[model samples]
Target: MSDALSEASDLSGDDSQDVMTPTELIAKLEEAWLNEKFSPELLKNKSEIVECVMEQLTHMEENLQRVRKGDVKASIHRMEIDRIRFVLSSYLRSRLQKIEKFFPHVLEKEKSRAEGDPSFLSPEEFAFAKEYMANTETYLKAVALRHMPPNLQTIDMLKAVPEPCLDSFVFLRVKERQENILVEPETDEQREYVVDLEEGSQHLMRYRTIAPLVASGAVQLI
Candidate 1:
């Protein structure tokens, strides 16, 4: 089956090729999901693609179970199945993390703060948001009713939520050089520094420090 999956593309001389195994299909689905996750324009209508991929995954799981019971050698594919499942789960969690970052607006409990007031989520994301809303509301109600201690009243959901900004301590390379780039200092008693970027020069800095440069295409995220 592994060999078949690798050789399946050569079976046809046309632009299209068949995926011979669940592994190959899941890999392709993961690629598409990652692409959709990064592109906001496609995210708005990504529900159909997500649903189709999920259905395919379910069918693959069912077929795998039958194969396992009928053939001893099929047990070798268990690792592959587990890996695919992990990838699928991680993909979903990554998207959910993003939705939770903007949960307030997604729940429609807050006014629009993003520019253009566009929805950066798909229908599947909206469902996840609804789940989050239900859980939060339930918790708040319990707290207000004194079912929980008053000590938990000061817990702010958003306060625990990490900033959706770039992470720290990541390396980045300059894509387009610009001089006189101003940056605010993070600590007291530190002098300000102007960025004199040069194309192709790599620098090891906190991602937050260079996030603006990345957004402006002056630097590349590595």
Candidate 2:
């Protein structure tokens, strides 16, 4: 039995060219769950699979960086990024399913509540959940992007913007006011001007401008 198991392991290790389809990978993982003797090796194989996925994610990230730097055209970079994102999303969905399987109680509870009482979560709870999920997703994206090469165009974009302007700009307040034709401009206003920005938009603007400025030592984030 030991010799047979050893031979099987060796065969698996040697078959590097055998590219596993996603379905095959999932089936292998499921098989690992059922067979106690195979579980350990299967777990190890899953890690290897995840590593392979990470490599692809890294390559995609490098391409995105190249686009950001202007080394690659925006359209091409975007397409590549989109492709990577799709594959990564698919893989993540599969991984999340496994996670759900492992934590069925927690996931089922959340899913049940989500299905049964659409309004089980208060507005605040919904907002919190959305923000939390968005933050987690962003973090994962950044991790994937870090593996990509830097974009050369980003440097040029950075060079185009003035250092002084970048440094002096401080985000103070944000407000939303409806356009009123009847309202006149205040000559001596007691109220300060408030700038309103959509969520995530400010961060996007900051990344485009502030990141480069900070890199050049022209701006600091408080």
Candidate 3:
């Protein structure tokens, strides 16, 4: 009886060492999620947010290994993992939708302005519009950075979008040209051709030059 009791005590000790507490697991998961969402500078410096996510995944894998080795309680670990995964996935999906919705209006405005006659806008006025568009892009990017997780799935999706598709704003250079206009007389006696010279033309002059408005947290897709 004494030997059996000693064996049972040893087994219990082993189990205790192997499993992580629920509180500890929850804390670690939350830390990983927050770091991924709120740290854009870190993500940029690192070059790939997916790498950071992989590191977190590796840590989780280690934890799983411990459970498999009978060091932790499988039921407890599974529960914690499931909870964290659900929260992260739901948050990311919602945030991506928000980002998509926010960019379209800004893009449309920039497109309209680019297509409009630049002669109507002074240099100062154009500059202000450009600055406003830039600021909107920056704001959107920052918001995205705060909500997205640096994960393989997200990164892959971002990479798939064409660069041009991502850039919704464009600037056009307008140039002045001379054209001839013909005037017809009501009486069939004579017809007159007159050349009307104007500083601005009805047609918009645009060059092939394209500028991409990249936002801070905007991920570049292929």
Candidate 4:
């Protein structure tokens, strides 16, 4: 049950006390997957959950290697491994796409982070973003900027790629009741209002309005 958590200290790079049974670990990965898929911007990195899942996969795979091919138990183990691999690869690919699309913004956010604040990116993601940024700048300068006047040559990537549409509509389910959340108007003619998020209720609303709630685990993006 705790096999997945065996590498917690090694993967997390800290003596983390957090522990989860295999079921809990899988649930966390699924939850994280949903949140990442729905959010316009990259959410906080779920490195802990990812690390544990990876550990589980590795342990299961090693056991499978000891079994003969096509055994019943081996078949089931391989199926589970493939399923986990699918989710893990999808989750990482989604993040990498965002990093490529919004590298400037991602790096800026990491740069401005205060000391002791939890990182929005994992170490690998941060390095990827940095490399992506460098490559982009080089490409731009070589193909376009070199021909432009000096004054016009400088490119601000932050302005070039717009930030994620935080105010975009999103569908979510309330996990815990939240009171008096402000909802901005859809049009100038309409007035802003507030509403309570009843537990277990699902609604379509602006992401910005519930952004904090999503980060706090008060709601689940459908």
Which candidate gets the maximum TM-score versus the true structure?
4
Listed in order, each prediction's TM-score against the native is: 0.46, 0.24, 0.25, 0.91
Candidate 1 on 21-114: residue-level lDDT in tens?
4445555556545533442211233334345456655665777877737465666566666776676676677667666666655455323436
lDDT of 2 by residue, 47-92 (tens): 4444444555565577566554555476675675575556545544
How many clashing pairs does model 3 include? 7
Write candidate 3's Cα lDDT for 145-166 as tens digits: 4476656213322233222232
Every candidate's lDDT: 0.57, 0.38, 0.38, 0.87
110 Cα displacement, candidate 4 (Å): 0.6
Q: Residue 177 in candidate 2 has what lDDT?
A: 25
All models, RMSD in angstroms = 8.4, 24.8, 26.0, 3.3
Better of 3 and 4 by TM-score: 4
Q: Write the per-residue lDDT of candidate 4 for residues 144-198, one digit (tens) a residue.
A: 9999998999999999998989988899999999999998888899999999999
Predicted structure 3, TM vs. truth: 0.25
Full candidate order by lDDT, most accurate first: 4, 1, 2, 3
User: Per-residue error at 85 for model 4, in Å?
Assistant: 1.0
TM-score (C-alpha) between model 2 and the true structure: 0.24
Residue 187 in candidate 1, Cα distance off native in Å: 3.0
| Stretches of candidate 1 exceeding 4 Å from the true structure | 1-92, 98-110, 139-145, 148-156, 159-169, 216-218
Q: Who wins the lDDT comparison?
A: 4
Q: Candidate 4: worst 10 consecutive residues by lDDT?
A: 7-16
